[model samples]
Target chain A: MSNQDQNLAATVNTTQGSYRVIVGRDVIDDLGTELQKTGLKGRAFLVVDEVMFPNPSRRAQEALERGGYETHVLALEIGEANKNLETVQIVYDWLADLLADRSDIVVAMGGGVTGDLVGFAAATWLRGVAVVHVPTSLAAMVDSSIGGKTGVNIPKGKNLLGAFHQPKLVLQDVGHLKSLPAREMSAGWAEAVKHGFILDAQLLDTFERLAPQMKALAGEEPVAAIRRSVAIKGEIVSADEFETGDHRVLLNYGHTIGHAIEKVSGYGTYLHGEAVAIGMMAAAGIAERLGMIDEELVDRQRRVLENYDLPVRASGLDVDALIEATKSDKKSRGGTIRWVLLEGPGKATTRRDVPEEVVREAVLAILD
Target chain B: MSNQDQNLAATVNTTQGSYRVIVGRDVIDDLGTELQKTGLKGRAFLVVDEVMFPNPSRRAQEALERGGYETHVLALEIGEANKNLETVQIVYDWLADLLADRSDIVVAMGGGVTGDLVGFAAATWLRGVAVVHVPTSLAAMVDSSIGGKTGVNIPKGKNLLGAFHQPKLVLQDVGHLKSLPAREMSAGWAEAVKHGFILDAQLLDTFERLAPQMKALAGEEPVAAIRRSVAIKGEIVSADEFETGDHRVLLNYGHTIGHAIEKVSGYGTYLHGEAVAIGMMAAAGIAERLGMIDEELVDRQRRVLENYDLPVRASGLDVDALIEATKSDKKSRGGTIRWVLLEGPGKATTRRDVPEEVVREAVLAILD
Candidate 1:
């Protein structure tokens, strides 16, 4: 076998439904060969985020065309602000006018937002159709693109509108990260940190040890780090694809507050990874305040996040607006906020009936 | 226990997540009892279609209020044309503004269109709030409401923007059908006929025998027929909620061609059931032409559909337009149409690549 094939075999595995996640550098080069394996028919509709369209994604589209797939480009606006029911319709209309069928595959060739919106369209298009994700951003590569969490945002909450539709394959090319902005790359690191916090204490230590390298964006380790993070998410999702039990809910560690922050900030004010970074810090603080964890652990987390310049504190935002947003969080039940708190490293649990005052205190303490 | 309660219990078993299909007269009176079972907190957001707002649904709403659930009515335009992303956003904004929480439930009180639109809103509201379906129209009562196939239409196709969000309860009051238009009632019968064709041959014979009763909108058996048909759809969906296998695809027996007709004609040109009626006839013809089923069965399906005044032919529609619409069908894979053809009674298989010429011949024969 060729060197590239050997690398792929080491990095990815095909499951029962033939769903696979391909990881490595220059993975986009193998798009045509992978599409052939999926047995999908017709042309490939390349749905990308506006930010990634003119740069990193062009080569992938050209490769698809060269592979004999009829290709159409549906460039969507980037960020969570555009991840809504309305935007989903726009992409659907474009594909419909193109006469896309089940034989065709929708290539989500950007970050989390693009992957989610297009994947949702693919899930519902013609009942459903095949989808291949070529996640271009760090967050997309490490987290969003792996789990099959495809959906758009509802005005009331993020990802409120979606389905559990898995992709035919996910091609993560680390080369795409070279084009990502510095802030976006830092945001993506938050998810990698999240993986460590929720499942692997050792992974957290690894992040701390590699903080200097990750901050400098140096070494081939980022690709390997991202692949490991994605594999962790994949294992969690595959065990409970529907989130019907606690396994999937544990993955929501900082998201309960993180989503509220995004919603109140109108989605784009803070990048998802940035907001999640602060939210995780707040959660760790709350756990400490509640005597659930030690102060040293919180300090450790804060120091590690500081290395990447991720915000672990909130300031200059309307506190009441944030509170209101939290109350409106999709996770709220009977008007009570549900916080997913870390009991210790690599362990988490959802704590509902969390007092509004206690939550406010947590937010206030985190404000600069 | 009340007489209706005892009667319902005899046929339907309600579980923790299981909803009830309330059939027969004055069933709206039980709305209060059903709401109690939904575990809703305080009030309900009652979403109704314009047609039903002035009729039986208003009575149902009154009944819900009397049963002690604070009620708020959200009246939406009727018909498939209005089931879109824009409408869902409007509902989301309204619900978010109201601060509706998980303790609250969205009561979708209308036909299939309203149920689909509202159910989708509920599914996305706060990541998903409890939903209770009060299906007034026969089509919804027998099919849409029970299956939990909640979604809105995208400009590209029908139900292309949606989620498989099951409702907390399904309240089907067959008594409400007395106010329905004859064409509307006939439209619903087509889906019931589809259920029989897919699963139970004896049910098909029963429908054939009761064709006159169905057309005249007479007899108590219509309620029983609706209950049985809903149960069949419920069982199929419950067994394979994601349509990952053959069992659920059988539910699309006539839908492959029916959806094409709907798209070509525009969503509201004909009621969904009406299109399905014609599509089923076309499918039967194709089956017989392929020598997969006896010609006598095709005639039987035609007679049964005709008795209900359902259009069994594609006459007057442009053949090319219909074919184009069929090609855009959600069931098409890799640019090839996947037709669910009946090999015999209660036996259907997905047949791909049944030549375009054969499909055209069937279409021409039906048009004739």
Candidate 2:
């Protein structure tokens, strides 16, 4: 009957079965209110990263308890390197011992790494239990927390061990971004920019206009920006929930090169989105060199990324190492490198037969 | 077309992803001939147990290669103890490093452990490649191989870590049973008896009539017996692929207590089906005592199992220890033990609300 309840009902209806990507300023403040709607009985397990728990974990626990739900917080070690089988086993064992059940929910409250590790643990524990994600970082807000691609990093590659287990809800409180480090904030913007480049030209234009304010946003615009980016991701995923089509693969436009960079640089060295920014530039160069896109268009795209202070090149990295890393990427099939090439702004396509020479040329050009 | 091709087509339909369940004497001799029908290209990754590989690995691999398919034999340490994350990771990495592609198929050529480990490897490698199962033991062919429930064991519980990955084809070569030790053969029969108790009174009647011959031919069975067992399992799994209902859980009639026994006995000490044999007797006693099933029916079931020399009593095992291990079972949800209890022959139900005291009393009775 109330205005707030009406909006909640609409969002809940749209997000049924598929995860809801709730983007708004100060959404963290509504954690208690929103979780009450899930109607799950018993205590909640709040699995938070050690880095975020001192501030946000307590707040979340307090909110859940206030909403008449019992809460227990489990703080985990942070970083991509910690995402492995050993950690997953430890978490599963802990939950098993704790007797956590389907009636209880796991709140994965951290960045992408934490959400992935926790979400996967939730998926596998007791066959499966409900998991709600409150992604605090930008990369997680727009991308990782929404798609339900949950897994840990194997020694061979990132997400080499995982499953397609969607979350119950994704609470993207852009207010959390106010506390995020500038570099991390910029990394998140790269993904938002990626959504714009891949599907919506108008989103790109709007992002360009508000790019400066996004960097300086206390709250309002960043929340709106995240909402738009999440909607784009949700629509694409809803169309092709599994990565069985080109539309889904197009979302990986900058990721092929980005994952290669992340692998070569060591997972935590550059931050995922930063590596992706540089990778996107490399992709643009590859497309232009192959006569798929105009050289001027490549420059225009670089300028937009530069405005956000995201990386556009890898200055000292070895091109050969990047090439080798790209070969082992999870996306590659039967030894062929699959690259997502830009046709123009707001358009991308997967090119599986892109010659190795073209990939090498693109790497070298980006290095220069 | 050759008579064999026409017979194969008539027996099995490939359109519904349905394949034959070869269940007769000398079935292993037909493995090479059967695999030819799958039209699989490239080499076969022959995964066998260390024990079985010594004798049958050479023959199996030779047969595959002789039929014009390359064969790469991989022998794993035998038993459930070896099924863990380390083994899964090693197998997956080996497959990736070996460049096994979609065209290639993995042959899980051992017992339940091999089927599970290799099946999981196939499911996760390159986001799933094809797998063919060559279950050497009765325990594997009669139950494990047909269900498509592939996964490795964890320290906390058996099959705590796994996936619901089905095999491309299951080669139930009855000839492999010739090599099974008497104890192992009896262990395998426990599951067939379980199928009888859970859903098929006709299977129970068949077992009663053929008990002597089935025991005498511990290493050999008439094609009819094997076919009946496989058909029962296949029909159950087809109805409930993910065990979301009573149809699939009924297949685990004796597994709840069986898993506990396996865990308490430290996995390899007792074969999986052996544990299930004891678990089944315990469950039957519980059902009888609860007045859910008639005592005469329990006696008849005991007579059939005893004829095969299967364990009916939980002797020399600490009751408290067994109870503690059962609490850690994967079947336990929210700390409540879910038991698949039988009301009568061919009737089973999962009861979550059964008191622990009742379970303890039945275990004690079985021990006596």
Candidate 3:
């Protein structure tokens, strides 16, 4: 590999230690085997999403037990509404009952909510222990599970209570996607396409080429495509360490307005990636008005999202309220929203100086 | 530095950044000036102990406001029973109301309970904001405040929920001690004396030379003595990173049974330092029985603890229940209680193989 290539080679590394990101069809089955590679000899505390219990979670627990990890399983009733400090409390109670110590590893099996909540539990349990993610949803596979960012929302805001605890490994298994709803599948593809839009035009092409199969959760290309998204996210997350959040801000390409949509819709209407997909449309339009990109790229993002059945427009919501919500976003600073926009495919930059009228027009263009 | 000197020359340096531990008569008045030196230009969220409000907390607040910080003050009712996730939520609500960002620093102006609760709050708020500790109680300054270990007590155990979040600075101002009750003052000295028993024999000698002055809160030697304890804690905390808690374990000399006593007594009867003092006596007896320490060394420990009015014996407690409680201590490993015993005034070592009968006799010898 070239010297530059080596530097771009992202490893889940920091003071937290570098770890592997494995993506394949049935890597979930290798949960125990993978943990073995980490040389861990502790009891396994497996916490699963409510929907994921008694099936894939059992499979994971059995795998861990078979691999000599004395395993304990708990299923949490989790969703965006339920993702709060209260959920994290349930986990602490379970760990305390078992006298869970520093020698234990917590395994989170399910989607992003499960991963984020359990990941946080692992982060603060005994001031932190090892955690491994078995991400079942496509969105989790390509996004939340890979990064060390773990948190639970508070009444005040999302992820307001958490720590930057990296997992020992993230096992992105595509096999579990077969059981997910079609809407959730489409929501996930929004993120994969956004990743393609920001850092790799080649990834965008791969999505365009294999849109049907990825949406259907069919063929080997789905894993290959998911792996590429994993690589892109890994590269960005590793590039930034904790604060300044500048380099990784590129990953927020659609999240500014996306988060606002989730808020305005009361977090129950659209899935995270779906709101993000609509936000990407708003961002693409913002870039277009500023002449940062040609109209063709905007058309490209929309078409790719459409191919996966991702929404390109949000209607009947107050655009003014959505704009106000953007100011309240985590990426917002000192009353200015840092908007991540593309100059073209695979090239993104942030701007805090975008005029309010320009943003209003762009946001309005994506509504109704 | 010589080989031995270098090993023991403790520095408060770690991935959390080496910070200054300033111990003086009126460092609380210098709060704003010190924060300015750290190059922080953000709003100050000063969370004070309920007792410290309107007097010293206002003084610190005035200093910060004079130093050009837009400060907000919140007084919390913090104690062992109230130190839980519910208490942390109050802080979250305050920060969210202020829209406190990462640039803002949370100032914990309190004793160990306030520091631990607020420190845990700061560690998770926005995934961590810089925090400075203005420890009001002597116990906090010489012990809890300097170390990054922050947590809340859950239903199952003490500090069963928290994180290792080090402060940006620890201001150990002894001026605040003038307002504390004599009983509380005695409790605080227990920790300073324990530090002497575990690491520096010179500190013990200084305590003997200045017992009257320290007891009366009368002179400059108390400041110097407190500074030495802060340095010792800084060294031990920085020596260990997150996982290997081995070096920091040395600082837990009396806390094994100290913690159990606090738990067995329903967490309200003894001040932490009082329990540790009694625990220290029990530990000395254990070391004597095992031939790890001599009877003269045990007597020497008792005299120093007595000079400061710290209790050297705990009476009327169930000996067997206390033994069972020790097994549930945070420091226990795989059913083995890692016991830290003194070989001499300045030497402490841990032993996990101490027999149950030996431990029981040592514990019973201190009871009525």
Candidate 4:
């Protein structure tokens, strides 16, 4: 691990808008200065996940206040179940009580749930207001925090209600992950690893090389992995902010199946990346069977996932139930499910022509 | 009443996104042709206001189906009270039941409530889907429909939840206004007349010239008024789609007090335009006191509003209550209320420097 002093920044420029992602060790120490640069003119409301308040959230509040910002911290109990319109109203009430205006800022600090919840509030408050994200978890840092996708879930589905609101900035403090549990850290790696499979071969190589010490995320390896993953995501989002083109869909390499798994097992049963890890294994299985990739590549993917202690299969799951779940996925156009398949490491393709029988076989094979 | 058989179209090119506003007599007759031109693929879901189904909505559905679209009409009972997340969910259920894809289109046909409701659903469903609007009332055609501002109300306020999802197109059929009650049609004119007060002197002249027959709305004059108003809104939105600058704030010429009036009077007591009419009067009074404009101009504004039968004052409202309402307005910057005051007809300015004592006097004068 490098533990270098300098910060790494990735700027995403899109037709919709543009912003930057900054990742570094102890980068959060500069939170106040960085927020001042976003052109936010009024008071700051720090919406933080309750559990993170002791260290990350409190530090953020102190830094923002130190920078001459009148700050208010709203601590929320966080979980998948709490990510809905009800929770958003609580934040709205806080803003209303403060008479927060368009010039004021909402700084979301926590994991994916907190960002999505606070981001949605900012998007709708006064039609819209500026929002900045300080992601405390790896899953949020590399994926959810960078895309400017803010939303809350309804009972019908996850992220069923949301808007494409770009954040003013996304601050990823790699040191924050030190407080993360080993299992949670490994689950977050699934997205970074999937980024490797879909966009960067060198990223895949780095993950493979660091597989043995994957849980030791205190140093440079974690930051490097997150930076590279975020850059790949930033580039893709810049090209297709609305997901209108194929480029954005390619980033969903494992989401089609991953989403269904999460839905079938019940949303909170598996961490999002855990589902993606298994989904990637299933997708690789299908790709290998179709000869899109050789058996060696599939073996490597499975080995890398296993080395990180992530799940590669779902036990006792019904293929038919899984198939039913995919139909409801937002990516499925009408009756056809668009699958993002791996042709080889770093080479992914979105195919809508995969036979249903082949899909069923792949799911059945991965059901353990 | 020109009833002349020519189509009028204005193409709105905004930095956020662009779409067209089409107005003509029997334009609903061309519903099928326009939807085809939007380049949308997949089935169409016509989310209509139930009251409009007997005439306008059914007409739109038939036209779309005739144009070779597989259309499903979902009629909803409309009102300000129904504009909430609960109603949005019903629309989502309809889309889910049919497995609506990103390729599928949602056509919102009716007035502002329908447009806001269906548009919000379209904005969030599957993260987003393409939506085209056919506004049946003058308010929808001139204001809400063109802005791409789609939202549902929360208990706290109107339009408290929404997204800036640009429509694929906006179609306004002038003939539909014939079915509207005389009061509703007149109420809608307040917004159009407002455009005249803030941006276009010619538009204000058109309203004054057509004042006698405005309630009748029998011909070319109505379509022309709508066309001009839409164009003005289109132009303003193009320059400031996100409302980040002073240009977009100009469009809120009367909305500050107008929104307060709506809030204090209760949501449904006065139509939106009616509240705006009174709000404009209050703004004009303040402008007169500030010597930004003469007493004669305020009187001219009052006469024009009276000619249209729109209220220029609220007889019994409390000044303190109205002032309190203004503080919570979205335009307010923390404790300071930003009022859009007029220098004269065709000239408006957004000011945050108005003394509280002056605001109280203006409200007191307008209370009866």
| Predicted model with the maximum lDDT | 3
- Residues A196-270, candidate 3, lDDT per residue (tens digit)? 999898988989988877777677777778878888888777778574767788988899999999999887799
Q: Candidate 2's residue-wise lDDT over B233-338, tens digit each?
A: 8877777766766688788888888887776776567777778988998898888878899889888878988887888776667788888888866667668887
| Highest DockQ scorer | 3
Interface RMSD of 3: 1.0
B157-268, model 1: which lDDT tens digit per residue?
Answer: 5676666667777777766787889989989888888888878888888888988776665677766677678778877776766676777888888887788788777767
The sequence of per-residue lDDT tens digits that candidate 3 reaches over residues B269-348 is 99888999999999999999999889999998889889888888877789988999999887776888899999888889
Q: Report the C-alpha lDDT of model 2 over A182-285, residue by residue, as the tens digit.
A: 99989989998998887888888878888888788744565566677887888787877667676678888788889888877766788888999999998998
> Which fraction of the native contacts appears in each prediction?
0.37, 0.05, 0.75, 0.45
Name the DockQ score for candidate 3.
0.72
lDDT of 4 by residue, B1-368 (tens): 22322454567776555677888887786777777887776688998888887666777888888778999889889778889878888998788777677788899988899998898899877667889999888888888898788878777667777778889888888888888877787778888898998989988998888886666766668667778898899888888887878888887877888888988888778888898888888888888888899998899999999999899989667788899998878777657877888876788888888998888888888898
Predicted structure 4: lDDT:
0.83
Model 1 C-alpha lDDT per residue in residues A23-47, reported as the tens digit of each score: 7777787787778777776789998
Q: Could you tell me how far off, in angstroms, the CA of residue A260 lies in candidate 1 after the best superposition?
A: 6.1
Q: Model 4, A86-162: lDDT tens per residue?
A: 89889988887777777888999999889988988998786678899999888898899987788787766677778
TM-score of the second chain, each candidate in turn, equals 0.91, 0.89, 0.95, 0.96
DockQ of each: 0.33, 0.23, 0.72, 0.51
By TM-score, is 1 or 2 better? Answer: 2
